[model samples]
Target: GQQVMQIPQYQHVQEGEDFTTYCNSSTTLSNIQWYKQRPGGHPVFLIQLVKSGEVKKQKRLTFQFGEAKKNSSLHITATQTTDVGTYFCAGEVTGGGNKLTFGTGTQLKVEL
Candidate 1:
């Protein structure tokens, strides 16, 4: 069975500090997508990486994909209260429609 693993269900950081979380899948993933869920809010799409060894950045946030497409990481350079949220990684399975399975999720807490 395929599985997605994530670490640090919760994380706290001081303002101006850095934070990072990792995601991994038991089976090789065809494509991966990252989502963010704000407190008391639903998940929102952040980014997706399809190619092996792909990397992308959004402002203070950076995302990376493993060469095997089975793992990924997200790094935030500076922590802020506005950066508080849960980051999730979803993978697309070979079979079925929109079979987007999500990771356990990394809850991020930024202190001011």
Candidate 2:
């Protein structure tokens, strides 16, 4: 079975600080999709990167596609209470019925 995991499941940061989280998998994937969930809300689509060596950013957030497509990362330049949420990366398995498998996911909290 393919496995995906993310480091620093929870992060607490002061306002205006920086934060980062990493996602990894035991097997490669065709593509990966990232989502963000508010403290008490459902996940909302963020972005998707499919090509190796690809990178995309929205405001202070950055997303990277691994060279092998087996790993990915998310970084935030400056933290704000508004950034508080859980980040997830979902990938597809080689031969699984489901097209998407999720990472452990990183939860971010920004302090005042």
Candidate 3:
């Protein structure tokens, strides 16, 4: 079974600080996906990485995939109140049935 693990399960940052979360898989992944879930809100798909060593950014957020396709990372340039949420990484293992294993998740809290 494929398992995804994330570090720094919880974070508290002052507004304007940078934040980052890492995700790793027990097996090589066919694809990696990132999601954000705000307090009292459902999870929202942020992005997906298919190619090895791929990097993508959206506004103040950056996402990266390891060359081996077994790890990924998400970084936020600046912490803001709106950025407070739990970040999750989901991965699909090679040859594994369409099931996606999600990481433990990293919770971010921004103080004004």
Candidate 4:
């Protein structure tokens, strides 16, 4: 079984500051998916990274996949109250098919 873990289990950032969460996998991953879950809400898919060393950006958010394919990171620029949520990284190991191992998650708090 593969394990996925995220660092900085909790993060607090002032509005206009930046935030980041790092995800690491026990085994090489074929692909990784990022999700955001607001308080009392189910996880919602945000983006996916497949290629090694891939980098993607959506608005003020940035995502990067390590060249080793075993780690990934999500960064938010200029944090806002709307950015408050738990971020999760789900990894699908090589040959694991559609099964995904989800990380413990990183809870983010933003305040003015």
The top-ranked prediction according to lDDT is: 4
Q: What is the C-alpha lDDT of each candidate?
A: 0.92, 0.89, 0.95, 0.96
In model 2, which range of ten residues has the least summed lDDT?
A: 91-100
Candidate 2 has an lDDT of: 0.89
Q: What are the TM-scores, per candidate, against the unseen true structure?
A: 0.95, 0.93, 0.96, 0.98
Candidate 2 is scored at a TM of 0.93
Q: What lDDT does candidate 4 reach at residue 11? A: 98
Lowest-sum lDDT 10-residue window in model 3: 92-101
- Model 4 — which ten-residue stretch has the worst lDDT? 92-101
Report the lDDT tens digits of candidate 1 across residue range 1-112.
6789998788999999999999999988888999999989999999999899999999999999999999999999988889999999998866647798899999999888
Q: Which residue pairs come into collision in candidate 1?
A: none
* Model 2 regions lying over 4 Å from their true place: 94-98
Each candidate's clash count: 0, 0, 0, 0
Error of 3 at 53 (Å): 0.2
Q: Encode model 4's per-residue lDDT on 14-104: one tens digit a residue.
A: 9999999999999999999999999999999999999999999999999999999999999999999999999999999777769989999
CA shift of 44, model 2, Å: 0.6
* Model 3 agreement with the true structure over 3-111: per-residue lDDT tens digits: 7999989999999999999999999999999999999999899999999999999999999999999999999997889999999999998777877899999999999
Ranking of all candidate structures by their lDDT, best first? 4, 3, 1, 2
